[model samples]
Target: MPEFNAPLRDMRFVLHQVFQGPALWARLPALAGTVDADTADAILEEAAKITGQLLAPLNRSGDEQGVTFAAGEVRTPDGFKQAWQTFREGGWVGLAGNPEHGGMGMPKMLAVQFEEMLYAANCSFSLYSALSAGCCLAIDAHASEALKAIYLPQLYSGQWGGTMCLTEPHAGTDLGIIRSKAEPYADGSYRVSGTKIFITGGEQDLTENIIHLVLAKLPDAPAGPKGISLFLVPKYLVNADGSLGERNAASCGSLEHKMGIKASATCVMNFDGATGYLVGEPNKGLAAMFTMMNYERLSIGIQGIGCAEASYQNAARYARDRLQSRAPTGAQAREKPADPIIVHPDVRRMLLTMRALTEGGRAFATYVGLQLDTAKYAEDPDERDAAQRLVALLTPVAKAFFTDTGLESCVLGQQVFGGHGYIREWGQEQLVRDVRIAQIYEGTNGIQALDLLGRKVVADGGQSLKLFAAQIRSFCASEPPYADAVLHALGQLESLSQWLGERASSDANAIGAASVEYLQLFGYVAYAYMWSRMAAVAKAQRKQEPDFHDAKLGTAAFYFERLLPRILSLEASIRAGSSSLFQLSAEQF
Candidate 1:
C-alpha cells in the first residue's frame, strides 16, 4: 500500500501557506461558520486517514478486479460499494457544494484536497464522488428550483450518483456533430433519444438512483453546439415525495473496457425515448454543460496531482530502502552489504524532481480552487472579476500540467522499481496506468490547449494573461528572502507570456497549436510564485517551526533551479506554433 504522510503535510502547506485559507475564509460570509484553520486541518487529517486506510487498501484490488457487468447490473470491485456508502455517509459528496441545497458549502480549496486524496487512494472509487459533485454543482447553478429541491440532498448525500452525457458515437470534442435529439411531450417533458459513449459511472448499482445530465438538441433547434440543451434525465423519475417512480427509458447498453481506471465503469448508454426535463433552457444546453466541463477539468487536474504524489511516495520509499549498489560519495551506512539507491545522485534527482513537481502542482491546484471560491463568494466585484480571470487562465494549465507531470512522475516511479514495476503486485505499474487517463479525459490536453490559446488568451487579447502577469509581478516585487530567484522565475514567465502574445497576434492557429506547452509554462511560473510566497511566510515564522519553513525554502529553491527553467522550452514551442502545427496537410497522414 502507498503511504500518504508526506502528501498530507504538503496539503496543509498548500492550504495555509500558498492560499492562506484562513484569511480568505474570514472574508466570505458563506464560509464564516464552517471553515477555519483548525476546522480545515481537522478535515485534512480525517481525509488523509480515510484515503490512506480505506481507499489505498483497495486500489490494487479494485484495479485487478475492476467491475463486472452481469445481467444488466454492474458489480464494482470488492469494497468499492461499501467505500462509496461511507463516502456518502460522511457527506463528502457535497464538500464543495451549496449548503442551502444540503451541500456542505465547503470551499473548493478544501474540497480540492479530498479530490487529490481520492486520486491517491483510488482514482476508480473517486470517480463516483467526483461526478456527483460536478453534476450537482451544475444543477444547483442552472437547474430548476424543483429539481434542486428534489435531487440536491440525495446527490450530495451520495444516496444517488450522477453522470455527464455529452459524447456520442459520432461526436467527442466536436459536439456540433452530435445527433442526440429531444422531442417534446405534453407534460412539459422531453424524450431524449441517443447513445452516449465513454460515460464514466454511467451505469452501476452503487446507489439507489442515478441522475444523468444529458445533452440533446430540440426538434426546432438550430444547428451545432448552440442548438444543444441540457436535460435532467434520471434513471428512475423522482416522485413529489422524493421516492423513485417508474424507471425511465434510459438504459446502459454496455461498458467500455479501457486501458486504466477500470473500476470507474465507463458505459455506453442508450436513451430510448427517455422522459426528461430540461435543466436550464432549451437550445442552451452546451453552454450550460460547460459549467460541468470546466469543473471536471479542474477536478481532473487534482487527480493528476494525487497520482503523482502517490507515485512519489512509493518510489521515494523504494529508493531509500532498496540496497543494491555502493554510494557515489563515501557511504555513511558502510556496515551494510550495499548502500541504498537513495545514495545515488540520479535516483535522488528523480525523487526530488517528483517531489518538487507534485508539491508545486498541489499548490497550483489549491490556488486555482481559492480563486474559484473568491469568484463566487467575494464581496467585491473587482476582486471577483480578478479571481475569475485567474480561474479561466489557470484552469487549462491546472488540467494539462498536473496531469502531464502526473504521467511523467508515475513513469519515473515505475522505472525506479525496475522489473518489479512491470508486474502489478508491487503497485508501481498500476499507478502509471491509472494516471494516464487524466491527460486524455475531460477533453484531451490538446483540445484544452486550443481552448486556452483561442478562447482565453489571444481571443481575449491577452487580458487574462495580463491580469495573471500583474499578480506574479506584485509578488515578485515583495521583499522576500529569496526574492532574486523568485524574480528570475517570474521574469521568465513574463517573457514567455510576451513571446506568446506577439506570436498569437497575427496567427489564429498559433493559439491552438501552442496552447498546451504555453499552459504548462504558465503553470510552472504560477507555482513558482506560490513557492516563493510560501517560503517567505515560512521564513517569517522561523521561530515557530524551522523544519516546515526550511522545507518550504528548499522546495522553492528546487523549483527555481530545476522546474522553473522549463519555460524556455515551452516558449520555443509556442513561438514555433501554427507553422509546424499547420504545416501538415490532410495528405500528410
Candidate 2:
C-alpha cells in the first residue's frame, strides 16, 4: 500500500473555509479558550501522524491473520496490540466523549476527522476504539454515576474495549422480535441469558476487559420493542473497590468468517446466567441503544469512505507508474516499452470518479458531523431542534449513499488496477474486503434508506426536508457564484422530495420501494450543491490558490454533468411502486 497522506489541505479547507469549525468551537462556553485554529491544526497533525505512521503498516497483516480464538480466549492480529496501546495512550478513542469521563470533549466536527484517519489507516484496529467510545457515550448518557465512575475511565483510556449487543439470530432490524432474556436479581442486577450474534469487538485480547451494552427482554416487560430493556454486561465482574474480578459467564460462542474485515472480531456471544446491571429505564432500551447506533452508522459510512480513499490512492499511484499500452495520440515514452496506463481516457474517467467521490464524501461527512455537534451542543432549542432534524434526515443518506458511492469508488479503483487490484499483492484488494462490512452491518444500508424515506421524510410531513431546503435556497438565492448549479440541483431535490413525501402517505410500501434510490438521488444532488458551495467559496477567496479552487470546480462540474443524471433513474424507480412487492402471489418467484 502507498503511504497514507493526511489530506491536511483538504481537511483544512473543510474546517476553516467550509464550516469555520474553529468559530463554532469558540462559541461553546466550555470550549471557549481551549480551542483555537492553531490548537486544532496541531490536533489534526498529531492524529494524522498517529494514523499513517503507527496504524497504516499493520492493515494488511491484520486482515490476513485476523483474531485467533482458542478455548476461552481471543488474540488480536500481529502489531494490533501495540497499535491499540498507541491509540489508547493518545486518547483518540474519546475525542468526542465527556471530559468528565477522561475524554478530551472535542466536538464531532474535529473528532469525526480523526475517525476518518483511523478508518483510513486500518479499519480493523479502528473498530476497537470506535466501539469503546460508543460504549462510553452510552454509559455517560444513561448509566448510574457509580457505573460511570467505574467503567468510563477504563473505556476512555482504552484499557478496556466495549461492544453493543442488540442483534440475535432472529433479530437485527426488527429488534421487537429479539428473544434475549434478562431476569432481575435481589441485589438490583440482572441475570442475562441469551445469544447475541454479529457483536463487533465482543471478545478480544486487545483490551484487558470488554463491556457489552446488551439488550434483553425482562420477564415482566411489555411486548415489542417497547418492552426491551438495556443491560450492562461486563466480561469481568467489578469488585467494590473498582478492581477487575473473576471472569463472568459470558463467552464467545463462535467467530464468523465474513466476507471482509476478517481481523476485526465479530462474535456470537452466549450469556448463561451472566450478571448484568440495568443502564437505562426498563422498556426504553431501544432509544438508549440508538444513541450508540446513530454514531456508529455515520462512522460505518466513513469506514466505507476510508476504504475508498485508501483504494483510490493505491490505484491512482499505480496508474501513474504502471506502463501498459502506448498513448492514444502517439507512441509516448517512445524510448521505453510503453506509456503509463493513465494516458487512457477511460482510466482517467475511473480515477476522476474516485477522486470526486472520495473528496466529496469527506466534505459530506464533515457537514453531517457539524450538524451532530450543533444538535447536541447548541444552546438554543430551535437551533438544536433544527440541527437534530437535519441529522435524522441526512443520516440514512449519509450511511447509505456514502457507503454506496464508497463501494462503487473502490470497485472503480480496483478496476483501474486491473488484475493487480484483484490480487493480494497491491494491498488495494484489502481495501475492498475491509469496507464491505460497512454496508452490511450498522443496520444495513437498506434499513438506513427505510428510515430516511419513511420515518425521517414522510413521517414528519417533510418538515425536515423543508428545513434543509431552506439552507440550499438561501445560499442559492444570495450566493451567485453557486446560484445556477446549486439552484438547479436543489430544485430537482425539492421537487422529488415534495412528491415522495406526499406519495408515501397514500402507499404504505412506497417509501420502502423508493428509499434506496431516493437516497442515492438525494446524495448526488446534495453533493452537487456541496461541490458548488465549496467552489463558490474557492472562487471568491482563493484566486491565487487555483490548485484548490480548480479541483473544487472540476469536482462540481463532474457531479452536475455525470452523477446528477442518476436522479432520472431514481425518479423512475420511486414511481415503480409495489407492483413487484405485493403484486405477485405469495409463492411467486
By TM-score, the best candidate is 2
State each model's CA lDDT, in order: 0.85, 0.85
- The residue ranges of model 1 lying beyond 4 angstroms of the native Cα positions read 1-3, 495-502, 581-588
lDDT of 1 by residue, 51-120 (tens): 8888889888888889899767788998988888887788888888888989888889988888998898
On a 0 to 1 TM-score scale, where does candidate 1 land against the true structure?
0.96
What does candidate 2 score in Cα RMSD to the true structure? 1.5
Model 1 / residue 559 / CA error / Å: 1.6
Pairs of residues clashing in candidate 2: none
Question: Tens digit of lDDT per residue, candidate 2, span 1-589?
Answer: 5567678888888887888888898897767666778888899999989999999988888888888888967788999888888888888887878889798888788777888888888888888888988899889988999999999988988898899999999888899989999999899999999999998999998888999999999998888999998999999999999899998989998898877788889999999989999988988998998888888889888887888888788888899899998888988788889999999989988988888888788888999988988888888999999999999899888888878888898889889989888898788777887787788888889888888878887778788988998888887776656477667767777777778777766877778788888788888878876777777777777777988788777776777677777787877877777567787787885
In model 2, where do residues sit more than 4 Å from their true spots? Answer: 331-335, 480-482, 580-586
